[model samples]
Target: MTVKNATAVRLAEILQTKRLENPIGNALLESAARGDLRMDALQRLVGTEAQAHRAELAAYGTMLARYPEHPAADLFIQLAQLVYAAQPKLRECAKALGMSDAHSSRWPAERATYSFNGTLSWLAVQGSQAACALASYTDMKVYFSGCTQFAQRVRTDGIDVPPEFLAYYDDEGSEELRQLALDVVQNGLDRGDDEADAVFCARLLEESIGEFWQSAAGTI
Candidate 1:
């Protein structure tokens, strides 16, 4: 999809060769070992930049784990959105969600059932539980961009794939969207995050899928 620059390509190659336990965390050392990432990019990456490199984030996560009271730890978590393992609110919310039966009583349906509170709670539960699921700082933007692109297609061209109908934005009230939301409901605070991803897929397919699904809740 995206063509990497020469240096970026080389960096990937170097990273692959390291075969390190924490790949992103070791990127800087690996690149420096291979002498590819240098100068401005290197300084910005290793030093401190608004957008943290994967390795930097990894290192920060590690440091926070070792020393949570390290002054700016909270700032890092808030700014970088590296709440993959942040505590307190996420911990408490996840615990409460865990107490519930999760998917034991519910199964994903063929149409979405919107619950703004439920969805927000689910995001926290999933996001907090699955550390490293979102690998980068900009990962959220990447997700939003993907959904926005598809939303545009539905809004302008009215694209609607049949059967699987992943792009059935116009027909988000379809069974597929409901099915996705159902999966989220069923998965509930499970260890993995695919179900959480499904929630977004349904939500983004039609911005109003939640509302529409909510409006029709219990009818179907």
Candidate 2:
């Protein structure tokens, strides 16, 4: 394989291993699949997600500013647009789980849950575009799978809310987004971004994501 392709493949392999080892994601998916996740816990998950998306939107902006002329700038722009477009749906999902606007606004922030955002923001400001893109891909890999399963189970179980609330999660463009990120990583490699640094950033982001899931699981 070419160096860029090899790097992407290696990153994916490492991230997949970590993703499978994430107990919290597994538990949450299994609980939702079994229709055993409590309403309050699900509410908390949605509320937390809303907050995280807001942070993600801003972080993408920061990344765009930092990489204005780079190919990764397009990835940042697309991500921000996706996050903005998905907010209304996410709020509707929150309401379906009995969270009022006021209630969601009043939800207490968990340190562990926000850790991923903190790391993401830090990367946006100080890390390479490749690092940020790779990290985001690692994080999204698990989240997208969970969301797809959740939407499916919600429909199968006849949940009150429209499954379309999660329609953005499994967006038809999701694979495109992945390709954009991988392309950005390849560009970064061509420009001499340190492979080890990119891998470490992805690992760090993945760990923070695990912390978020662990904190969310605790709410259940």
Candidate 3:
């Protein structure tokens, strides 16, 4: 289905809203938040793979050294901070949902280390952001799919999750969110920014996945 412009913007807002209420979703959103900035930065530079790789590697090295303890978690947290700082509206929405900024910091740490390959594979096929903007339009599709599944589960099980809380994964009337994501992807692609942003976002995502591996290994 073709997404409308107004709906596209609304989807972005809904995605933002979902992130605020769901810790797991927030962690994924944090990666996209950081990836967005990295994409913006990379777009301004001119270089082939070798040159860009050297620069990005150096930056990653610095990041690794500076955040020796839970580097990936730290990076995600930082990204969350940036999003919270820049998007007060999101903060307010989250607050109304009874979640706090502290949840963002603790959530990533609570999960067991996940496989980089597995997470990337899932994210590549599912989830949102510049990385999976086009391809199969899988980013938002995966999310909506998940939301639908969760809703079904709730209906069948009659779980006790609050209605407001359900907003995190609700897409009952979210045609707008889906449309917004498509618009963002199309706009990014049309401007050639999509390719660059996708690449950068992918790298950042890979790094986080690697960090998860490291975190798991360290515990072992």
Worst 10 residues of 3 by lDDT: 41-50
Residue 158's lDDT in candidate 1: 42
Q: Please, what are the lDDT tens digits per residue for candidate 2 over residues 101-121? A: 522473436787687788988
Best-performing candidate as measured by TM-score: 2
- What RMSD value applies to candidate 1? 21.9
Ordered list by TM-score, greatest first: 2, 3, 1
Number of clashing pairs per prediction, in order: 4, 0, 3
lDDT of 1 by residue, 88-204 (tens): 322232233332221222222323332322333233334331222222112232223433444454344443323222322112222332222222223222434443353343333
**Between candidates 1 and 2, which one is better according to TM-score?**
2
Badly placed stretches (over 4 Å) of model 2 are 1-4, 20-24, 33-36, 102-106, 155-173
Backbone clash pairs for candidate 1 read: 108-182, 110-175, 111-178, 112-178
Model 2 deviation from the true structure expressed as Cα RMSD, one decimal place? 3.0
lDDT of each: 0.30, 0.72, 0.37
